[model samples]
Target: MLRSKLTDSPLLKVSRPVSACSRCRSAKVKCDNKLPACTACEKAGREKECTAANDQFARGKERSYVAALELRIEKLERRLGYARSMKDSVALNGPDEPPAGDPNRKDSMAFIRAAIHRKAVQTQEDADINTLVSDFGYLAVNTTTRDFEPSESNMTFARLVLAASTNEPVPTPRTADLPAESTARALVQFYETNVIPIYPVFPGTLLHALVSDLYQQHRRQIRSSEYWLFWMVLAISSASQSRSRRDEHYQHAVEFVGRALPHADRALRPGYGTQVQSLLLLTQYSMLDPAHFDSWHPIGFTCRAVVDQGLHQDPPHIQQMGQDALNERRRTFYCTYALDRAISMVHARAFSFYDEAVCVALPSPFQASSTLSGSTTAKRSPDASLPLFRLRQLQSEWYQALYQGNPNEHLPDITSFIWQKYREMWEWSERLPPDMPAAIREMLELELRYSYVYCIASNARGAQVSAYGKLLIFDHVISYVDRIYDIAKLAENAAVYTYHDALRVLFMGSQFVAVLQEIGDLILSGSSIPSPAPGKVLPPPRPVRLDRGTGDDLDRSVRCLERVKLTLRLYGDRWESALSCLKNFEGLSAEVWKNLTTRQAMRNPAPTGQWLPIPGA
Candidate 1:
C-alpha cells in the first residue's frame, strides 16, 4: 500500500516547468515576463516590446539530468567490465574434473578460451562506445558512420559544418592559383577525366551533375585576382566549345558569376579589376545560349551595373602587380576591349532591341519626315540626291569587294568617311604638343593601327568573298605580323623582343604566306578577279589551271606545305602560332594542304625527311 501510494505521488512523476520564465509562473494571471506586455496583450493592440528573462532553473535541471544519465551509463559499463573479468577468469581455469589426453576436452577448453577473448574484446569496444557517447552526446553515432565511409556530399556538408562551427576559411586548390594556360589545361583535364568517359553511356543528368560539380569546385578556388579572371575566361571558352551541353554549362557559369559579382565589386586591386570585364563577357556568352536567355536576366543587370560603376570611377592602377608589370598596359587595353566585345555581343544577340540604333541611317520614312523640312528637301536638286544613291551603291560595291578575294577594293563613300575621321584624328594628334605622354602616343598609335587594319581587311575587294560570310572579317594575318614586328622593334627588353619577334615570324609570317597562296589559287582558278586597277590597263584574265601538271605546281605545293610544317616546328607546340596560321588561311586552298599534311603526319610517316625553310631563305 505504501509502494502504491509512493508510485502515485506527484514527486515520482517527471514534470517540466510550465513556463520558461519563473516570474511568469509566479504570477497568478498569465504573465509573459516581458518588460511591459505578453503576446496576448500585444495582440490586443497594446504597443509593447517583450523582454523575457532566461530560465536558469530549467537549464540547471537539464544539466543535472544529462549528468545523471552519464553517471548511470558509466556505472553500468563498470559493472559489465567487472562481470566480463570474472567470466574470463573462470574460462581460463577450465572444468574441475579434467579429461586427460581427450581431444574433445582440449577442444572444449579452446572454445572456452576463444569465447573469453571475444568477450574481452566486446567489453573494450563497449567501453569505447560509451566513452564516445558520453563525450559528444547524440553526435557519436553520426560521427562513427561518417568515419566509416564518407561520400562527396557528406564530406562537403561536413566541411561546411566545420567551417561554420570554427569560423575557418576554406583552402584554395592548387589549380586555382595557376596561370591562364595552366587553368585551361586543368579544365581540359577535368573534362577528359569526368565528362569524356561517361559521355557515351550517360548523355544527360549524370554528365550534367559532373560538369556542375567541376564548375563549383573551380569557382571555390578562385582566390587571387588573376585566377578569378582566368576561371571566368576558361568557363566561357569551355562553354563555347560544349555545343550540346552549352546551356547546362551556361546556367552553372551564370550561378557562379551571380555569387562572385558582389565580392568582385568590392575588390580594390587593379590587377584583379579584369574580373569585372570577364564576368560581363561570361554574361554575354550565357545570353547567346538560347536555353539560358530567359533565366539569366541578372546577367544584363550585372553587366550594366559593372559598366556604370567602372566608368564613373577612376581608372584602375594597371602598373601595380609584379607579373602584370610587363604587359600592364596591354592587360588594361584588353580589359576595355573585353568590355566592348561583351557589349557588342549583347547588342548582336539581342538585336531586336539595339537594331534601330545600329541602323540609324535606315530610319523609317515617317521618322525621316519628322527630322527633315519640306522646303529644304525641295531646295535640294534631284541630282544632288544622286550622291546619296551613289553612296549606297558604293557601300554595296564595298560589301561585294570584301566578300570576294580582291585585295584592293575601295568603297568611295565609306573610304571618304574613314579618311575624314582619320584627318580629324590626325589634327587631334597634331594639336597634342610634342611633350605629350607616351601612353597617349601609344593609345593613338593603337587606334590608328586598328582602324587601318579594319579598313584594309574590310575594304579589300575579295576580302569579304573569301571570308565565308563572317561579318567584319579581315586579313589579320598580315596586320598581326606587322604589329608584332613593330612591337618587337620598340621593345626594350631583349627577351621580350625575341619572344615577340619569334611569335611574329612563327605566326604572322606563315599566315601571310598562306593567305597569299590562297589568293593566288583563287586568281589562277579564274573563279574570281582582282580589283580594277586605277587608270591602268587591266591585265588579261589568266586561264584557269585545269590540267596543271603535278611538276612545278606540285613542287610549289609541296614547298608551301613544307613551309607550313617548318613554321609549326619553329613554333614548337605554340598554339597561338598555329591558331594564327589557321586564321590567316581561313578561305584559302593552302589551308587544305597544311591540314592534310598535318593529319597525314599525325597518322603516318612524313614523305620528305628534310624540313622546308622559311620564305626568302
Candidate 2:
C-alpha cells in the first residue's frame, strides 16, 4: 500500500526536461524551465534569481549566442521604431481627439527601450570577446561607462534604466574589520615596490613607525584619524598590485575611506601632516577607479590644503620647527605639484598648483632611520623622485605650450624650448645608473618617447609649421611608433610587467598605430594617397618587403596593436581605465580589420558572383 501511494505521487509521475536553468544546471540539480522562473529555484526559495540560458540555443540551426542576441536586438529595434513613429505623429498632428496615451511618455519609453537594447548588444559582444581572449589571462569584460556627459532627455532616461537595472546590493568586505598583520605587511611591500617609485607619498621611516604602532596595539596612536588614513592608503595601494584580490582590497579601502571621511574637516586644518598625507593617498587611489575617474577634484582639494598650510611657500618662521618638518613640507608640496600636473593632463584641465607660485624646493633624500634627521638645506638629494619631478616639470612645460597653444597658428617661439627639453630628457636618461634593471630602464624610455610623440603630434596640429616641419613631425611620429611596439612586446613578460606601469601611454600609442595602419591599407589598395600641402614633401611610401615570410608593414602594425591589447588585458583588473581603453582599442581594431578585408575582397572579385578559393587559400 505504501509503494502504491509513492508511485501515485505527481512528482514521480512527471519527468524533468533534459535542459535546465542556468543556476540549476550549475548546481547539478534538475529544473523545470518555467517562464520567468524555474521549479528548482522555487524549491530552493530563489525564484527571483532563476534565469534560463535559452539565449544560448537556437531552433533549426547550430546554436549561436551572438545570433540569439541579434534576433532580440532586431525585435527591440522594430518596436522602438514603431514607438518613435507614433511619438512623431502625436507631436506633428496634435490630437484633434484626446490621445489614448501621452506622447512624451511614449517617446521616453521608446528611447529607453532602444537604449537598453543597444546596451544589451554591446554587453553581449564584450562578453564574447572577453571570453575569447581570457586564455591570455587578464582581459576584463567591458561594462558601460557611467561618466559620459548626458544632455538628451532620452539619455537621462537611459541612465535611469541602467542604474535601476542593477539592483543587487554591493557586499561589504569582511576584511575591512580585520587588521591581519601578514596581510598588512604584504600590502605595504606591494605599495613600496610598485606604487611608491612613481608617487612617493609616504616616507619609509614614517610608514614603518605607523605599521609598528598599529601592530603593538598602541591605542594612543592607532585610534587617531591619521591611522585610519594610513590604513586606507595601504588598502588601495595593495589593491592596485594584485588582480585576483583587487575587488576585496578595494572594498577594504572603501570601508577605511568611510571611517576617515568624518575627520576630513579636522584633518584639513593648517599644518596637519596626517591630513595632507591622507589627501595625497586618496587622490592616487582615485585614478585607479572609474567611479572616481575625475582625479582633479581630490587633487584640487589637496592643493587647497597645501596652500592653507603654506607648504607652497618656504616656511618664513623657519626656526620654530625641526629639520624633518621643513623637509616634509617641501616633499608634500612637490608631490602635490606632480599629481596636479598628471591630473590636469588626464582631464585636460588647468593645474591647481602653478609653477611660478611655488617657492619651495624639492625635498632632500629621505632616510629610513629616525636618527638620520639633519639640516640638508639646498643640497638636492640623489633620490629618483627629484629627477622624476624635473622630468614631469619639463612635460608640463611642453604640455602647456603644445596642448594649450592657439590652434590657428603654429607656435614657433617654443620650438627651441622643445629641443632643449628633449635634450635634457636624453641627458637624464644617459645619467640613469647603468645598474638599473632592464625593465625600469625600458619604462623610463617609454615615458620619454611618449613625451616626444606628444610634442610632435601637438605641433603637427598647428597651422604655423611649414611643410618641412610637417615632414619632420611625421618622421618623429613614426620613430615613436616603432619604439612603442618594442616596449609593448617587452611588457608581455609578467615577471617584468607591473600594474603600476603606465598604460595610458600604451593606449595612446596603439591608437596612433591604428590610424597609421588605416592609412597604409588605403594606400596599398590604391584608394588614397598622401596629399601634401603646397610646397610640402610627401612622405615616402612605406617599403614593401620582398621577403614574404615577414608580413607587410600593415601586419606589423596589427602585431603592435595586439601587444598593447595583451598588456591592457593583464592590467585591466587593477585599473578601470585599462579595461575601458581595451574596449576602445578592440572596437577600433574590428573596424580597421573589416575595412581592410572588405577592400581586399573588392580588389579580388569572385567570378560571376560565385566565390571560389584563390591559389593562396
Candidate 3:
C-alpha cells in the first residue's frame, strides 16, 4: 500500500531543507516548509510566497511582524497618554497619595510650588505684550527724532556700532564697562559740540581739556599699529587747527612716535615692515614744518644717531628683530637732508634764526663729523653714501645761487646753491671708490650733469655783459650737453635710460640753446649790426637732420631738436640761432652713435613734404 500511495503522489526530492520564518523562530513555533503554501502560514492567513533568503529576516513574514509591532506601539502610547494625564492632574492639585518613606518630600513640594509660580509669571508677561500692542496701536506715525544734534548723534551711533561690532556689551553709567573707543568717541563728540563753538572765547582751556581727554582715553588704549597711525594723524589735525595749541600737539606727537618707534621697528618684516617704517618716519617729518621748527639741527642729529646705531648693529640682530636696517639708513639720510635744507634756509634769511637755533641743539654725533674716525669714515660705512651725496649737492646749490645774484632772492639763491653743490658733487664723483656699484656710480653721474646745467643757467645773466663771461658760459653749456650725451651712450641699464632721464637731458639741451641766444643778443647790442624788423629776429639757416633709426630714438632726438628750434624762434627768430644750436647737438649725437645705421640716416636730410618724427614716438 505505501508503494502504491507513493506512485500516486507527485513530490519532488529536495537536496536541502528550507529555513523557517524569523517570526516563527522567535515565537518558538513550528513552520511548514512549503514552496508556495506552507501549512502553518496558510492557517494563520499569511500569504505563502518564496522570497530570497535574507540573513537579517525570515522570508515573507515582514508585513505581519510590522502589524504586530504597530499594535503593541499603540498600546504603549495609550498607557503614556494616561500617565501624562495623571501627572497634569497631580500638578494641578496636591499628590493623590502620600509618600511612604521619601525623605525629600518637603523639598519636592517646594520645587513644584516654585514651578507653578514661574508659570504664573510667564502668563503675566504674555498679558503685558498684548496690552502694549493695544495701547500703542492708535499712534500712526513712525519717525526718527531730528531735534538731536547731528554730531552728537553721529558720535553716539559710532560708539554703539563699534561696541556692537566688537561684541562688547552696551555700557551703563553705573557699570564702567564702556570700551575705550566708545569713551574716546564720546569725549571727542562732547568737545566738537560743546567746546568747539566757544573755542574763540576760551580756546586754551577747552583745547587743553580735549587733549587731556584724548590722552587719557584713546591714547592709552591704542595698542595696535593702525591706532598709532591714527593717533598721529589726529595730532596733526589738532595742531593745524590751532596755532597756539601747536606746541602741545607737537610734543604729544613726538612722545607718541618715540614710543611707537620701537613697535614700528619690531613690526618691520621683510617687505611691508620696511615700508611701514618709511611711512611712519615720513609722518613724523610732515608734522613739523621746516619754516616753523625752532631748530631742525637737533632732529637731524637724532636721526643720524638712530641710523648710526642701527648700522653698527649686526644684520643678524636686525633680522631677528624683524627690522630692515637698510630702510632705517634711508630714513636717516632724508632727515639729515631736511636739516641741511633748513639750515640753508636760515643762512639765506628765508627763515628766522630762532627756528634755525632748534637744529643747533642736536648732539654732535648727529652733526656731520669732520674727522675720518673709523666710525665716521665714508669708505667704511655704507650708511654715509646718500647723506654724503646730498650734502655735496646742497653745498653746490648754495654757491651757485650766490654767484647768480645777491644771495637773498629766495628762488635765485636756491638755484645758485644747487649749482655750487653740483660742482662739488662732480669733484666728489671723481673720488668715488673704484669698487662702487655701477648703479650708484650712474646716479652720481646724473646728479653731476644736473648741477652743471644749473651752473650754466646761474651764470647766464652775468655772461650777457662781458665777452669773456659769455664765451665761458657758452663753452660750459656745450660741454655739459656733450658730457650727458657721453653718459647716455655708456648707460647699460634701462633704468638709466628712463623717460625722465631723457626729459632731463632734453631740458638741459634747451637751456644751452637759450644761453646761446642770449649771447647772440649781447653780440647784436655791442656790434653796430642793424636790427631786423620788429618781431623778426630770424634764426641763421643751417642743415637739419631728421633720420633717427627706430621710432623711439628718432622721437627723442627730434623732441630735443624741436625744443631748441622753438626757443630760437620765440626769442631770437634769426635762423642763425637755431642753426648754431642744432649743429652742435647733431655733431655730438653723431659721435655718440657712430655705428648705428639709423643714426647715420638721421644725419642726412629728409625728402620735401615729410615732417620730422614726433618726440616720444
Candidate 4:
C-alpha cells in the first residue's frame, strides 16, 4: 500500500569533508583547512606536500599502521643515502688498487666493500625469511609437512608457534645503563672459570684482551660489534651463575644482541676472528631463552657465516697462520657442528651442514697451555670434551638413521637397534680417559645412563613381552634411575651444575617415573604379554634381590619423585623449562600416588605383614 503523498526522501549524506590535509593528517598536526595547502604545511615550508586525504584510504585512522609505513619509508631513504655515498666512494677511490711496491694487499679494500655489500644483501634475506615465516601460516605448515610427512615436522611447527606466541616483549638496553664495573668483572670472572671450561669454545686469551681493552677505555669509545658481543656473553654467562640477576642480565643480553645484529653483516667483512666468535656466542646463548623469536633462527645464519669465511676448510698454509687463529677456527667450526647437531635433535629439523662436507680439525686433546699470543703448545691432558664431542657425533648418527629416513620403511626392530646402540655407546664410554676430572666424568656418565633409559622406555611398546620380562626390564631401568638420583644428589652438593645439565637429568628422571608407573599398571593388570622376538626365545628373566613392592616401597617411590620435583624447582629461576618439567613430574606423581593409595586402602583390612603377590608368577 504505497501512499502517493509527496514524501521527502532522505538527503544523500555528502562524504565527510577532508578535515586535515594529507601531510598534516600523517603528522597528526592541525591543519588550518586552507585551500591549495594547509597553513601548517605552508609554515613548515612543505606547502607542496599538503593534499586532501585519499578517499580510498581505509586505514587512515590507524596510527600504528601509519607509523610503520613512515618507518619503512625512512629506512628506504637511509638505504638510498647509503647507496649514493658508496657510489661516491667508489668513484673517488677508483677500485682500490694495491700500492705500487708491496703487492700482498691485492685489491683488499675493494674486496672489503664487495664483501660488505654481499653480507648486507644476505642480512636482508635473513630478516625477510623471519618476516615471511613469522606468522606460521599455511605456508610454513605446508612446507614443513611436505618435507617431513607423518613425522616430526608438524610438531616442530607447533613448537615454533608456541615459542612465538608466548614470547613477551623485552625492553631495549641503553648503552649508558651498563652494570657497574666491579659487578661486571666478577660475573666475567665466574664465566671464565666455571662456564668457559665446560664449553671451551671461546678463546680465553682473546677474551682477556677484549676485557682489558673494554675496561681500560670508555664504553662509548668501543661501540663496535665485538664489544656488544662481549657484553652479551658476559650477560648470558652471568645469568647462568645466579638466579637473582638472571632475568635482568638475560634481557640486557637480548637487547645488546639486537643492536649488534645490524652491524654483524658489516663486521664479518673484515675477516676478523671476532665475527665468528660473536655469532657463536649469540647462538649458544640463544639456546637458553627458548621463547625468543630468534632463538633457533640465528644458528642458520651462523652456519652461513661460517661457510662464507671458509672456516670449514683447512687452509694449505695453516702452519703459516697464527697458531691461535688456526686453533680458534678449528674450535669454532666443531662447536658450530655440535650446536647444529643438537638443534637438529631438539627441533627435529635436518642438519644445515653435513659432516661429510666438513674438513676442519678437531680441537686439540690437550688444554691450551698459555695465551694464543704465546706458543700453541700441545701436551697430553684428560680433555673430557674431546670424548664428549665424539659421543655426540655418535649420537647424531642414530638421529640420522631414525628420523632422517622414511618413517614408513622397515627398519631394525626397536629392541635389537637399541641394544646395538647401547653396546656401541658403552664401548665409546670405555675409551674416555680414566683419570678425567670427576665433574666432567660424572656428567658424561649420567648422559650415558640417561640415554639407555630413554631408549628402552621410549620404545617400550615395541619391546612388549610377558609380565616377567617387563619386570626384568623394570628392574634394570630402576637401577639406572637410582644411579641418576645418586648423580643428581652429588650434583646438588656441587655448585657446578648448569641449567642444561639439570634439564637433562630432570627430563630423564621424569621419563623414568613414567616408565615405573606404566610397569606398575602392567603388574596390576595380570595380562599376558607377547615375546618381543617372534621366533627367538628370550633368556630367562633375571632373578632380582628385591621383593615385591609393598605400601612402604610405593611410599618410597613417591618420596623419590617428590625429591626430583624439589630439585627441578631449585633450577626453576635459571631455566624456564624447569618449571614445565616440574609440572610434568607433579602430574605423574599425583596419578601414581592416587593408584597406590587406592591399592593400599583395599589391602588395609588384610594382614599388615602381607605383601602383594607378583603378577605372572
Candidate 5:
C-alpha cells in the first residue's frame, strides 16, 4: 500500500514552512519553521540543536565564498565587541553576571543584562549567533595527521591531490634493475649544480644518505619519502638535461619516474611532514615533464601541505628548534611559495594564498653538501634562491594589484602604481649579488621584464594607459622575447627551464602583439615618448637603446612574435605541454603575425583597422 506524509507541520495551527528542522525530521515530528530554532525543538528542549542544512546553504552561498567568510567574521567580531562592552558595564555598575555553568551559559551566551535593575532576556538573534559561532571550528583537518592505512581506507591525501591534478597519469614503472652507481651519481651531481641552487627544499645530505642506503648498503629499510626523493631527483635532473623527448636522458627520466610511483601512496601519506617534501619533489619533476604531470597541480598541493602544517609561519624562537631544521623549514615554505606565485602569474590565476598569508622570513642560503668529504657547508651557499624568492614576492605584489584585483574596483592612480612597481623590480635587478650565477641572473632578468609588461598593461579597472605606457610595454616585451629566444636556442638548459617558461614567452608575446596592434604606427615612427610628469614617484625612463638599433618597429615586432613561437617550440622539445603553448600562441597571433608580415613589406602602411583597442590605452 502507498502512503503519504505531510511535509510540514499541521499541529502548529498556523502557516508552516516547507521543511522541518534536522531535530524534527529525525524524530518524525512536525516543525514550525522558526529560524534559529523550531517550535517543536523548543518544546522538546532541543532549541540549541535545531538546524536546517538548506537554510545554511542558501544564506552562506548567496555571495562569493571568500566574501561570505569575511562578512561572517566581521559579524562575529561585532558580537564579541558587544560582549566586551557588556562586561565593562557590569564592572562599572556591579550588575550581577551569570555565574560559571549557569543553565543559560550552556544553552546561550549571557550578559544581556544592562544594569542591576534590568532583567536579562536573550533574543533569537543571540541564539542564532551562538549557533553560528560554533560553525567556525568546522574544518580542523590536518592532512599529515591522518593515517589511511591500506587496511583502513583505500584513499590517501596524496592520491586525492594527484587524482585532481594529474592531466596524464604517470606511466606504470618497470621493475628493471637499478642504474649503475656512477650513472646515479652523475644525475645527482647535475641536480645539485643546476636545480638545488634555486630550490633547496631538502638538505643536500638527505639525497646522498638515501643514495648510500639504496646503492651501497641495500641493507637498511628505506622510508617511502627516501625512495621518492632519490627517484624524483634522478627524473628531474635527467629531464632538465634532456633537450629532446626522444633522447636517452629523457628515456631514463621516464624510467625513474615509473620506479617512483609505487611509493607515492606511502610517500605522500597525508598527515606527515614527509608529504610536503615528497610533493615538492614531484612538483619539480612536473615542471620539467608536463606530459606526465601538470606542474600547476603539484605546486598547489604542495602549498596547501605547507600551509596545513603551519610551515608557512616561522618558529617562535631559535631555542625551541635547531637552527638547521628551522632554516630548512623556512626554505621549504619559500620554495613552495615561489613556485605558487610563478605558476599563478603565468596562468593568470589567483594564488592559492595571498602574500598577506605567509609569515615566514627568507631563509639563509643553503649550500650544496660538499661531495669531497661528504660534509655540507664547505662554503656559504651562494644566495641564488634568496633572490628568486624575493622576486616572487615582488611579482606577487603587483600581479595581485594589477591583474588579480577586483575587475570592477578601480585602482586610484594606477599609472603611478605601475611605475612604482616597475622601479622596485628594476632596483632589485640592480642589487642582485655580483656572484649570482649567470643563468640564475638571466632568469630573474626575464622575470623582471615579464613583471614590467604585466604591470603596465591594465586589463582590469585602471586608468587609461597613455601611449608612453604602451611604449613601455612594447620595449620590455621586445627585450623579454629576445632574451628568452636565446635561452631556448641553447643546446641544453643552463638553469632549470620548464614548460612555464614557454607560457611566459607566450604571455610576453601576447603583450607585444597587443601594443603593436594598438599603437604600431607611433611606435614604429620611433617618436620619443614623454614620461609621465613626476609626482611623488617617477616613471621609468624609456627603455634605453633596447629598441633603438632594431629594424623598423614592425619588423622588430614580427621577429619578436616569431621568436616567441620558436622559443616555445624549443621548450616544447623537452616538455610536450610547451608545444600546447606554441599551438595556443600560434593560433592567437596568427593574424597579427600575418598582418605584421603584410604591413612590414609596404614602404608606408596606413593605420590598420579593427584591432581590439587596449583597455586603458
Candidate 6:
C-alpha cells in the first residue's frame, strides 16, 4: 500500500525526467520532463491518466525517486534508532563507558562534552588524513598506506633515505641565497651541456619553462615538481664544478638542496612515474654532493622504483601509448639503469637487478627541445645518451657474469670472453659522434677506459689472471688515471665527475699497483707478454701512449703511483669520501709504495745534482 501511494503521488518527480507523460505526448504538447504527471494533464483534469511515455518500468509500479527516497528514509530510521539507544550512553552514569564513581564524569555537562569531543577527534583525524593525501598531489603519490599515515607515526620514504644517507644537514636558505637571474641561467646552461646529454631523463622544454616561470612569472603558481627540478638542476651544476669543499659553488649547491628538500616529499612520492624521474634527479645531485646526500641511496631507490613499476621491461601492449610516452618511459628506465650500474660498480657492490632481469629497449631518437634561454642540450645530437646506455648494458652483462651471478666459477673461455668484451667497448668508443660536445665526448671516453680496465682486472673470480691480462690492466689504468686526473685538476670540470670517480680512481690505482707488485719485472721490463691463447684473438695491444715519457720501468711505475696520489688528493678537495679513498689506498699500498721509493732513491742517487722531474709533467 505504501508503494502504491508513493507511486500515485503526482509530486513524485525526478529532477529531470527523460520524456513527457503518455497523455502529453499523445496530445502533441510540450512536456516539462517531470515524472508521475505532466502539468498539462493536471490542468486538463486528467491527472489520473498521466504516466511517463518512456519509463523504464512496469505500469503502476514505479516512482522516479523511489530508490533515492527509500535509501534516505532507511538512513534516517537507522540514525533515529541509534540516537534512542545512545540517549543513556551519553550520560555521566552510562554503564557502557563511565567507570564506577569516576570523578571525570561527575558532571552531566562533562559527559555531554566528552561525547562531542570524542566525535570531533574522529572527524579531525579523517580530515587530517584527507589533507595529507591531497597535499601529496594525490595523482602522483599514494598516501593511503596505513603505515605512512600520521595517526601511527611521522615517517616517510623521503625522510627515511635522507636521514640514512645525509652526513650533514643542508643549510636553510635566506632570501638572499638565490643567485642573480643571469647567474642561474649560466648554471643551468652548464647542467644542460654536461649532465643532460648523459641522462636525458626529462624533457628540456619543461625545465626551461620552469626557469622562465620562476624568474618572470609569479612563483607562487609554480608546481612542486617544477621547484624540485629547478633547484636540483642548479645544485647539481654547481656541485659538479666544485673543486673544493669550501668553494662557493659547493656552498650554493648545499643551499639549493635545502630549498629542494621541502618540495621532495611531494616530488618523490611513490606510485607514480614521476617518482622515478624525481629519484633520478636526486641521484644525480647526490653524486655531485655526496657529503649532503649519498648517490647509492637515491640510485637504490630509483632501481626499486623501476622494478616495482615494471619499467625494466618493454610495455606489453606498447602500441596503446603515444610515441612520446613510449620514448620517455624507455629513456627514464635506461637512465636509472645506467646510474645503477655505474654506482654499483664504483662501490664494488652487487647491482640491484641483473641484465637478464631487464628487457627494456633503448629509447627512440631524441627530439631536442629548446630552452627559453635558447641554448645547449638543444645543440647536442639526438640519441647522445644511447652510447652510455649501451656501455652500461655491456658493463652489466660482464659484471654480472664475472662478479655477481657466479663469482666462484670461471667462464669456459675467460680470456676470449674478456677480449671480446673489450672489443665491444672499443667499438662503442670509436663510434662517438664527432658533432658531440667535447665535454660529453671526453666523459664517454673516460667511461670506456674505466670499463675496459674494470672488466680486464680479475678480482674475485677463481681463475688466475694471466700476465697479459695484468698488462692490459696496467696500460688502461694508466690512461684512465692520467686523463681523469687532468680533468679533476681543471678549474672547471667539463663533465659530471663525482666522489664515485674518486672510488674508481682507488680501484684502478689499486689494480695498477697490484699488477706491478706481482710482475714488476715483466710489466716494467718494456718486454711484450704473449697472449695465453696464441691462436685466438690476441689480447688488446698495449695502450699506444701519445707521450711515451722518457723513463725506464722503475721511473714510469713511480710516476704512475705518484699520479694516483695526486689524483685522489685533488678529488679529496671536492669530496670527503675521496679523502677516505686516498687514505685507504695509501694503507693498502704502503709496502709497495715504500719499496718503489727505495728502489728509485737507490738508482737515481741523492745530490748527484739529480733533481726530481716536475710533478705535473
Give the winner by TM-score.
5
True-structure RMSD, every candidate:
27.9, 22.9, 40.6, 24.3, 19.7, 20.7
How does model 6 fare in lDDT? Answer: 0.70
Q: What's the best-to-worst order under lDDT?
A: 5, 6, 4, 2, 3, 1
Which residue window of length 10 is worst by lDDT in model 6?
7-16
Across 21-135, the per-residue lDDT of candidate 6 in tens digits comes to 6676678887653334556887888778887543423445433322333444465566555654665566444434654455565565656655675565445544443333222
Question: TM-scores across all candidates?
Answer: 0.26, 0.57, 0.28, 0.58, 0.72, 0.72
- Candidate 2 vs candidate 6: which has greater lDDT? 6
Candidate 6 colliding pairs: none
Residue 602 in model 3: lDDT? 62
Q: Compared with the true structure, what per-residue lDDT tens digits does model 1 show for residues 464-561?
A: 32322111111333333334334433431111111122333443333344444445454223343443332222222222333345433334334444
What's the CA error at residue 21 for candidate 2, in Å?
66
Worst 10 residues of 3 by lDDT: 140-149
TM-score of 5: 0.72
RMSD of 6: 20.7
Question: Model 3 misses residue 5 by how many Å?
Answer: 99
Better of 2 and 4 by lDDT: 4
lDDT of 5 by residue, 1-617 (tens): 00001111112111112245667777887554555576677777988888753443343333232333356768767876675567576633334544333545533333333432233323434444544433322322235444344344555555655654565666766666778887887777777767777888876666766777787654588787788788889998888878888999888898999898878888887667788888888888887776777666677667767765778778777689988888988888888888888877877866766666568888877655322221222344366888899889988888877776667666777777777888889899899988665667777787888888877885666567888889988888888888778877965344467878778888888787788778877777878778768876788887774656767777788788879888888888777777877898888887777776766546554467745433112
- Residues 1-617 of candidate 3: C-alpha lDDT, one tens digit per residue: 32222222312111012334444555556544443444556677765442212223323322322233345556556655665565565554433434334536766664565456445544554444333323221221111111111232332211211111121121222222322554334333332322122111112243335445545634454333444333333333333222222345444434433333333322321123233333333323332322222222233223323332332223443345433334434334444444444333323222111111122111112211121211212221122244343544454344434442343344533333333454455557667657544444555555554554444344423432334333333434444444444444432332222222333444566554454445544432344333222222221111122333534433333444444334323222211223344455555444222323344356665688887553223
Residue pairs in clash, model 4: none
lDDT of 5: 0.70
For model 1, where is the 10-residue window of minimal lDDT? 363-372
Superposition error at 160 for model 3 (Å): 27
Q: How close is candidate 1 to the true structure, as a TM-score?
A: 0.26
Predictions in order: lDDT:
0.34, 0.51, 0.36, 0.52, 0.70, 0.70
